[model samples]
Target: MTLTPTKLSKSEKTRQAILEAAQTLFYEKGYDGASVRQIAEAVPIDPAMIMRYFGSKEGLFSAAALVDLRLPDLGSIPRDLAGKGLVRHFLMLWEGDRSGIGLPILLRSAVSNQNVADKIHEVFEEQVVPAISGLVPEGEEDSCAGLIVSQLFGLALCRYILRLSPVAEMTEQEIVERIGAVIQFHLDAARDTAGSNRP
Candidate 1:
C-alpha cells in the first residue's frame, strides 16, 4: 500500500492562486493600484473569474487581506504581565522585514484605504479587546486595548514602515521592554482607575 496526498479541487486551487497573487499585488501596488484584471493575469485565469469568485476587487482584497491577530490568551497570563505579553506578541509579529505578515501590508494600505483601516479595527476589536477583557477592570477593556493598538501601530509605522532612526535600530528585546512597559501601563492604569472608583 502506498500513501497518497489529498488534492485540492480546481476551484480551491484557483482561489488560493488568487489570494497569493492578490497579496503580492496589494503589497506592491496598494489597494487602489492593484486591480482585478492584474490579479487575474497573475493567476493566468480569465478576468471574469475574479469577479465570479470574489464579486469585485474590494471583495477579493477583503478575502485576500484577512489577518488573524492570533493574540495570546491573556486569561491564563499573570495579571501584572499581561500588557507586556501583549506588546511582546505584537513585536514578534512586526518582527523581521515583515515580508510575509499580512499586518504590515494591511497597515500600509490602511493609511490610504478606508476599507483596509476598517478591517484592522474590526480585527483588533474582535480579537485584541476580548483577549484582555479579564485582565483589565470592568469597562476598561475597550479603552485600554485602543491605547495599546495605537502605540503598537505607531511603532510599526516608524520602525518598520518608515524605518525611522533609532527606532529601527533598537533590538527586539529593547522594543519589548520599552513598548511593553507602555502596554503594561495601559493595563495597570485601567485596573488602577477601577480600583480608585470602587471606594
Candidate 2:
C-alpha cells in the first residue's frame, strides 16, 4: 500500500498566494494604496502573471474580496427575535477576526473607490436581499434589506471604523440589544405597512 498527498496545481497555488497577499495588502494599505505590483512583490512573482491570472486590478480585487454573508437561517429563530439573532451573528462577524476580511476590506476601500462601492452594492443585492426576503413583506424585501444594511453598516462605521466614543465602548450585548431592535423595527414596519390595508 502507498499513500501520496494530493498537490494543488502550480496555477492554483499561485492564485491562492496572490489572494493572500492581496487581502493583507488591501487591509493594510487600502485599495488605492495597495498596487498590483505590491501584491506581486509580496508573492515574489512576476507582476505580469497577476494580470494573466486575474485580468485586471479590479478583477483581482473582486476575486479577493468575495464575501459570503454567512447569514443565519431565520427559520430557527423565533419570528419576533430573528432580528436579534441576525444582529448578534453580524456583531460577531464585525467584531471578531471576520472584521479583518471581506466586510471591512470592502468598506474601507469603498469609501474612496467607486469600483469597490459598486462591489459592496452588488454584495447587498446578492447576499443581503435574499437573507431578508423571508423576514419582511413580500414586495418590500429590498427596502427592508436596505434599512437593515444601513443600520448594521452605520454601526460598524461608527464603532469600528470611526472609533467614536460611546459607540466604540458599547459592549456586544448593548450592540445586539440596540442594533437588533432597529433591525426588528425595520422588519416590523414592513409587515405592519403591508397589513395596514388603508385605502
Worst 10 residues of 2 by lDDT: 1-10
Residue range 1-199, candidate 1, lDDT tens digits: 1122267777777787888888889877888888888888898899998888899888888776777777888888787787678777887776643333678768889889898999888888888889878888778889988888889999998997889989999988898888988998888888898889765
Candidate 2: residue 75 lDDT (0-100): 66
- lDDT, model 1: 0.82
Whole-model lDDT, model 2: 0.85
Residues 1-199, candidate 2: write the lDDT tens digits. 0122267777787788888888888877789999999999999899999999999998888877877778888867788998889888887776666333778789888999998999899989988899888887788899899988889889988998889999999898998898889999999998988889523
Best by lDDT, which number? 2
**lDDT scores for all predictions?**
0.82, 0.85
